[model samples]
Target: MTDHRYVCSSCGKTHEGLPTDWGFKLPDEVFDLSYLDKYRRTRSNTDLCSLDESRFFIRGLLSIPFTHREGEFAWGVWAEVSKATHDFYLENYSNEMAQGTKASGVLANTIPGFPEITGQALDIAFQNSKSRPFFSFPRSAEHELAADQRDGIGHNRHHQFLELCGHFDESEA
Candidate 1:
């Protein structure tokens, strides 16, 4: 049995007991195999025997600043398309792309549902990004994914991507 000791932060009471006696839960850490357990369960049995062995990495990306502990919860909504979700969705991405006609000065006529999905993913990333430890973080950084925590997914590139997209002269190409 593992020895355990803990102190009550509010009551100033000191307690000592077995690790299991208190029944307190602990946060997960990086490099922990169990970190991705939640995502693993959602996968089909035919996919793979294990996550570490899988080509795609499992990430627990979160929108930062989820501090409204008493009010709204991030889980109340969704995280960006999980890396797995994004991978599983690869096939659908192209189909969502429109076949462009140069005559119209556009590549694809309409990306259709792609934009909506894209927006939702972006929103989730931004939410997690805002969940930072410091409030001084630049506003531009708000539209990003959380750090690549052991269990957290990192949505780092989205902002740079959005910036690039904003200035890209598709017509010149």
Candidate 2:
């Protein structure tokens, strides 16, 4: 796909390419805490996060295909995992054997324009040492996000997401 150019609504600057990936800097639960509480109860880096010394989370990519395009859009989102799964991930960090490892978790972000999906069941699969794990819904999941993932989304719907996230070409709008 060609690069998408858009004038950012938030910054009021002309951004050259449309971003295919969007992410949250922190999990919603931690993000909602007060400044002091967040720092006192959380320890996080780019890929892993721990809250209250008990809750564990890992960053992952959730990709949805474009119905009429050659590529997919991705969300760099976080997942809440069991302590055992989180420990296993840390133990296998940067190890090739970690590839294909699967774990059950819950989506940790409320994606824009979608109903509250923060606690939705999610399945994660590790790609390799170099890439973040990929997130998916269980086969039995019944939600709009799951349907979009399974059936693909139209270009217009994708554009709506871009706009919702403050990335939109005014000319097209």
Candidate 3:
């Protein structure tokens, strides 16, 4: 299998590598709890692995993609950023994010090429939400138009995360 790597443009830090084909093209949303749990554990310690202020930022980074927007807030893209990028965003945007300032400001500030990066993620997320990955919509019609766009954003997020880790896997999305 080929190896994959994801680099953080902000700090130029590289995250863990993975088998290029390990998860890509497998299947999205397999709900691999064991894998997630293991990753969670590994990720928790990452904060301490970098800048002192970055610990909480790492957790927040992970939260970006894992958590879905409930009402007016959702940022599940951070989990995928290179550790350095993760820390950068947290360090810069923690205050804004906490205060609920320009929503994507944190990302725009921390992640390099964040404008396009976020836009890409937006496409996949819109598609995923329309598919109702975790929950079913009350009506198909209500979510009909935004389905592909939403999921498309989610797809981009997955791809970006994989890219950050230097891994190119998409099956787990």
Candidate 4:
């Protein structure tokens, strides 16, 4: 098995290590008892484990919605970023907000010579509407075209998540 490490550049905090697994959680405001129970039951060692207050970094991102056949109505987004790079973004995020600068995902494509990291979304969101709405990952022209054409509320959307994560692996990281 391969070991994957995700670090936060801003706070110098390390998230998961080796054999990396990714997951997302609902914001505190949207919490529900039923979902919390499910989350508690399904939680495992492979889930995203963190030691610091930092939540996430930036590498690439993708969102997919489950189809009617797969589930009623649910969606997921995944982000992959190395520690240093993510730290930079987190700083930028704070600066941008504090200075009233416009928020943009352009950095997702501008990092040069950094290994591309990808994430697998194995968890379901409690409130899909509250999930991250945009992805900040660099994408190939082909992917952009396919994503635009696909209706984003079914199995097709889920496949796009897999496609984005499939672009690279631990060796690239």
The candidates, ranked best first by TM-score, are 2, 4, 3, 1
lDDT on C-alpha atoms for all candidate structures: 0.25, 0.85, 0.29, 0.32
Estimate the TM-score of every prediction: 0.16, 0.86, 0.22, 0.26
Worst 10 residues of 1 by lDDT: 101-110
lDDT of 4 at 170: 33
Model 3, 1-173: lDDT tens digits are: 54545554436676554222111211112122367543553333322222223222222221222223222112222223345544444455334323321121112112322333321221111111112112111223133212422343343454454465443443234
TM-score result, candidate 3: 0.22
User: How many Å off is the CA of 87 in candidate 1?
Assistant: 17
Candidate 1 or 3, higher TM-score? 3
Off by over 4 Å in 3: 1-41, 45-79, 97-120, 123-173
lDDT of 4 by residue, 1-173 (tens): 55545553335676553212223342221223366654653322221211233333332223433344543222222233344434444455434333322222222121112223223221111112222324422333234322432434544444344344442343365
Candidate that scores best on lDDT: 2
Q: What's the residue-level lDDT of 148 in candidate 1?
A: 16
What TM-score does structure 1 among the candidates reach?
0.16
The alpha-carbon root-mean-square deviation between model 3 and the true structure, to one decimal in Å, is 16.0
Which residue pairs collide, candidate 4? 4-18, 7-83, 9-83, 10-87, 59-80, 67-154
Worst 10 residues of 4 by lDDT: 121-130
**Candidate with more favorable, higher TM-score: 1 or 2:** 2
In model 2, pairs of residues that clash are: 4-18
